[model samples]
Target: MERAFVVLGAIFGVAGTAAAAAASHITGAGSGLDTAANFLLFHAPALIGIALLVKTGTVHANIGRFGGLLVLVGVALFSGQLALRALADASLFPMAAPAGGTTLMIGWLLVGLAALVGPRRV
Candidate 1:
């Protein structure tokens, strides 16, 4: 689980940087890839931190795992849909991006809650 989070973070970070570059150079303004890249970039470090916190007992394992799952799914859906639309002119679904965004918000809240309520080492 920890490895998964780190790998996901790396993947997202790489893809986000590439997408940002493409958006700037190839797509220009209004391509919408900028938003997707921003989400990926922002969440990359967060996902990694979640893994570390959980591993270190700063967050409950179960809650952290679940939150991380949601975060992964949320990123995939949100960024996937937007990138698909912008680059391939396709849609994952009608409301997939919005749903993903909401999921991300909920997952983040859960992660915070886990930290506050969990039993942590002194």
Candidate 2:
């Protein structure tokens, strides 16, 4: 699980960087690519940190794993749709971005809950 998160984090980080560069060079003002890049960049490190925390026994593994999965799904939906719209004028679905945003929020909330409710040491 920890290894999976780490791999995902690295992938996200690289993809985010590439998206950011593309946004700067290929996208104009008001392009959703920038938003996608921002979301990807922001969450990459968080996912990596969650993996480390889980491996170190600082967080509940199951909860952290679920949260990480949420983050991954959120990123794929939100960023994926935005990139598609920006680059190709397409939509993943009717409300994919909104759904992704909601999922991202839920994922973050779960992470916070994990921190608050996870087992603690003396």
Candidate 3:
């Protein structure tokens, strides 16, 4: 699970950076692509941190893993929708963006919960 988080984080970082570069080249800065890129960039480190914390006992392992999964899935859905919309002018689905955004928030909330609760004592 730690490795999964790290790998997903790395993927998100690379994809976000690439998308950001592409977004900058687009005429309108407010394009969905730009927003998606920013989200990916912002969440990437968080996912990585979750992995680190889980490994180090800073965060509850089970909770952090589940939360990290949500983050990863959310980014994939949200960014996937935006990128498709901006580039191809198509929707991944009717409400993929909103759903993804919601998922992302829920994941963050769980991460926060993990932090608040603290790790289980050895």
Per-residue C-alpha lDDT of model 3 across residues 34-58, encoded as one tens digit per residue: 9989988998898899999889988
Tens digits of per-residue lDDT, candidate 2, 43-96, equal 888889988877887776677778878888888899999999999999999889
lDDT of 3 at 59: 79
Alpha carbon deviation, residue 101, candidate 1 (Å): 0.6
Which residue pairs clash within candidate 1?
none
Colliding pairs, model 2: none
| Model 2 / residue 82 / CA error / Å | 0.7
| Candidate with the greatest TM-score versus the true structure | 1
**TM-score, candidate number 1:** 0.93
* Top model number, lDDT: 1
How does each model score on lDDT? 0.89, 0.84, 0.88
Model 1, 1-122: lDDT tens digits are 98899999999999999989989998876888988999899999988999998889888888888888899889989998888889999999999999998998888888888887895545
TM-score of 2: 0.91
Clashing pairs in 3: none
lDDT of 1: 0.89
* Candidate 1: segments with Cα more than 4 A from true spot: 120-122
Rank order by TM-score, top first? 1, 3, 2
